[model samples]
Target: MKFLATCPKGLEPLLVDELTALGAEEVKQTASGAEFSGSLESAYAACLWSRLANRVLMPVTEAVVETAEQLYAAVQEVDWSEHLDQSGSLSVNFTGSTKSINHTHFASLKVKDAIVDQFRDRFNCRPSVDRDQPDLRVHAHIYRGRLVVSIDLSGESLHRRDYRTESGAAPIKENLAAALLYRAQWPKCATEYPSVLDPMCGSGTILIEAALMKADVAPGLLRSEHGFERWKQHDAQLWQTLLDNAQQRREAGLASLEPVFFGSDIDTKVLNMARANAERAGLSAFITFERRDVKDMAPPNEAGGLLVTNPPYGERLGESSALMFLYRGIGDALKSRFGGWRAAIFTGNPDLCQAVGLKTDRVYKLKNGPIDSQLFLYTLYRKSAEQLAQAEESESQELSEQAQMFANRLKKNLKAMRKWVKQNDIDCYRLYDADIPEFAVAVDLYGDWVHVQEYAPPKSVDKVRAFDRIKDVMAAIPEVLEVPLSRVVLKQRKRQTGTNQYEKQGAKGKFFEVGEAGCRLRVNLHDYLDTGVFLDHRPVRRMIQQEAAGKDFLNLFCYTATASVHAAVGGAKTTTSVDMSATYLQWAMKNMAANGFSDKHQHFIQSDCLVWLKKQRKPQFDLIFMDPPTFSNSKRMQDVLDVQRDHVELIRLAMRLLRPEGKLIFSNNYRRFKMDYEALAMFDVTEISAQTIDPDFKRNTRIHSAFEVRWP
Candidate 1:
């Protein structure tokens, strides 16, 4: 019998190899699958052992046709009894359409009609149709004018491993995960029982696949139903023998297989899903699922292992910049923690691979669903301090003259800012702000740490050169600041939506305490892009503290509540902080606690500032600090806010809760803000933007705009 094993595109070679190993003879590869001559045992074994094959089909008949009638006649001529009984249920999966039949469903209906009529004419009875679990699954592939019919031996796509009762976002297909393991040379590793880890193991697909491979268990053994089980030519005795053999092998494999699988993910919900998947697969004992960040993922055991993961590719717009930083963190973790392990990263974007910083030993192109991706195999190793120093010195020597000039400028800025920062007793301040047009990065120092925010270079810049320049800047920052490389954190800044701004970029959970104006606040440089505090708002916060003495102060849109901390420290009678983020509110509470202002007088409210202000009629504030986002369409808010269009109403609502002699200080980071002087003619409004600009922000005049409004 001629059998065809179908699989995903680009995996035909792997399928052919898999079939050949499983005793399928005369194997010939095709674009979508492989064709081979195999007996009943060969077909059954292919269904059981072939991990890459989506379906194993036995060709029933074929005919050349130019019209739908001819196609129906071709299917009707086939001996359906050889595949399905008259009283059995049947399903037809049609692929392709010709000029005569423009739709696949119509073609499928024609084929089904022909089968029903043939059965009715032969025995006055026809089989019933069962789409979900049919006794016989007929696969009809129509080319330009030819129809090829086959009996699908595998009812469902083999990728549905029955273990995945739940899935995470963008989970990989199990077959594809198997293919990744095959390409990672896991078959060889399985013999030695080497450890395996997927740092971003969403739903534990890869870990489960690895464990299945190590156990030498047929992936289909767990399925209770298969298309071949109900077919007329199923050969029950042969299948029973195969099942018995599989069970025995599985038992022996389990006995010999030592647990070596480990997986980690930052999302706890997905970790639960991973655990459930492992438990359902009977692989719970072999794998350990932990809720860990990629940056903190080290080898689970002392034994050297293989690290394989499918990291996020930033397919969404405005996400690539953030993912680039994440890729860098993954690379850093690999270098620092898992030195002896082999690592494989499957990603669609090549730019993200460049950020990994490791030299790729091998790269293989494969399709991830519809996107073309590359699987980069790397040998991760830790470099000695001497070797790293030598490499940095070599990179420094190769830096371009332009990059060298930028480095010199950074040195000059740091030299000049040292005195100013010391005189003002500022522990955190901006050291460089895009001093050069070609090198667009902001460098800020927070005590012993440094945060470098890279501005997305324009399309006109050569990406390779831009990357090199950024590396040069990173290299120079640590040298100039006299800090270790690990103390320097790099982030890419792009136009971010209000909703995404609050999202955590990493899961380092590492925070450091920094001092600003007699206030000690915790700042996280790794987990978020903004470091929990905006350095540019130093002057604005200081102004709020000075003007908030002996008054009921209100801080609206209080991100991290730095302004609220200032007001409370300045001896405000009562202070209320309002924000939409619970995380920021927690951070605000921490900041307040750090400043010894965690009493009832210092309040943090989690609510939409607009809604909270509208509800405030009796509890009036003596001084209000309102700093709204430039634009917000956050789903948490009842209404979208555009500061340019809604500033008037926002200020109006804030003033309603203001006492008669109260002051309202409104500020925003919109660079091109133009206040509506005509709309606010009722109050004495003074623009203090120039005064709010600190010495560190002297290069950028429009860092932020502040206003003081009061009814005189």
Candidate 2:
């Protein structure tokens, strides 16, 4: 039988892992679901034992349909009277995606009409649609241009693990909650390591799942009916044998599992709710619950245990700013209170994650209902430096295996981060601050070049920790370049509202490598993010250097005029740098002045770049460097601009300033941007994305793209 298991956006891998373990064959992954071929017994096992699955659906038919008329015809063509009884009550559920037929309700109605009308035409009777508890629940998924109909294997969401009656605000679903633990390589922590604990165990979903899992209790055992029980194909004897086999398997697991479970929550009423839920699931004997704040937490006599918690995100719980404080307390408690144990935390907000100082080992993307959430995995065990060195030195090791056990703890958190970065189109943004103990490397990949700067966190978690991280991030570039300390100038960045003013400037003291083997360069230090030149533009700068021979160069919005300096160094006859900041122009002058250039060769214009470009009526330059701020509306400048909206016009205006066959090099950090190829049809545009972004920004390209445009 072909089955579909729908999952959250980021957890397809975990769900696939779960199904594969449960003996489901031909299991394949999907964006929001998994498709697999399995027997009825396999389906039952998935519901009974598998975790991380949202819904198990049995496929009834696969068809292609173009319109509502075609949808009814395809659904009716499936021989409705074969499996469904004419007298049996049933329900039709339709999920429509991008296709000619889009309305789910209307599509469902058409399917229902086809089934009932087909039955009326043949058997002289029709099954009525049951919206409540139906004998058979039909699910029609319209993806692209095809429709696949399936029957719900479980009556409700399998996450209703039947273990907890106690409900709290923002409680995780049962299956997803359990899947979190089972998918984690905690088994290597060994089965008998210690107790399972939840620091923020509101209503005890995690605790209950932990308890049932340890006891080897079938999640299905707690439920009276499964949707399969009503199916015409449901074999009573086969189901009985499957249950008998499952019970026997549980017996083996039960003998190995020790009764070690703990749960803590701030609310007294929630603890009571957890207890009630535990009792309903026959799990009261296996689980322990306490009313205690997460800040002052300790793992009971169980040493080297597991601590799982779901902290409040302001989005669902309305906790407000105090949540940050709460997160910091969580970090402190994890580091100080529970050093020997593992900790996994789930939260919707990443900023709050900054407060929890523990190094997340793995992060996973999990859904807590409709809201996107992260499950961060942090290993409690700390190996000595010697051990870390040995691990790193081992050449035969696979990165995945070593990180696998550690990864789950942080996988969910990483998934959360990945989604955020993808959404904001900032895949190149910083993932972790060095102040985080679990964090060591300031890793930013631009295109292909990966820029990694390693550092240790300060003992104190105050302003100095974050402040020191900024210094470390700034110090990284020069260290990678092997530049001297004398050549670098450190510029102090002012408090800009949009940018993180607290973070130190990127440019530091300049370094001149006497005979550097790779990319011999002069770098500038001081002021804002422009370090003599942007490292992200290594390739673009190189392109300018190549095209600079005998050309007149235009650098617009050119802070520090590094590109102009490069153009001059590349043998350009005349190079002009236009910017609103005179200080940057002077700094640009110093860069050129150091390279032995004077006012006679290089021109500096301190004017609004946009306005200056508008005033230039005649084309003069053979090359132009155009890199704009993502979005800005300055009081000093007359116009407000955004990269997403103004890119075309900016390119249009910039090209007018370029002489015939002159190149206009444009760059922006918005990753998901689509350039208006239609509007810019007058010029030839080629993407130099891979070339422009250095290794430091490669984790996500489209983090920035470099485009070259010239008249045909």
Best by TM-score: 1
Error of 2 at 565 (Å): 70
The lDDT, on a scale of 0 to 1, for candidate 2 is 0.69
Model 2 sits at a Cα RMSD from the real structure of 17.8
Clashes of each: 0, 42
Give a tens-digit lDDT track for model 2, residues 1-712: 8888887676788789878988999999987779898788788888776666768898888887788888888887787666679898788888875456667788888888988899999999988878777878888888777888888877777766665655877677777777677645544454545688888888888877776666667777777677777776677898888788878866776666665778888788888898899888766776788888787787687456887777877641113223555787677666655656777787776656866866778887766667777888887665567765674566234433323423343344345566654543432333322323443444433322223333423447453344333334434433433445333232222223332311234223534321111223344322233334455665676678778999999888787677777788788999988877766677677777767788687899987777877787788888999987776666546787678898888898888888987889998767677888888898899887887764435554665777888888
Which residue pairs in candidate 1 have backbone atoms (N, alpha carbon, C) closer than 3 angstroms, thus clashing? none
Candidate 1 lDDT over residue span 1-712, tens digit each: 8999988877888888999999999999987899999788999998888788889988889989768898888998888887789999999989987788888899899889999889999999999999998999999997877779999999998777799989988898988899898888896865433899999998999999988988988998977777889998879999999999999999998888878899999899999999999999999999998888887878897778889999999754335555766788788778766767888899988778888888998898888888898899988776788867775576447546775787799888888887888888898888889878877888888899988888878778765567667767876776677899889887777877868778887667998789888888789988776888888788988988888889999999999998888888888899999999999999999999988886889888999999888887773799999989999999999999899889998998898888998889999999889999889898889999888888899999888889999987
**What count of clashes does model 1 give?**
0
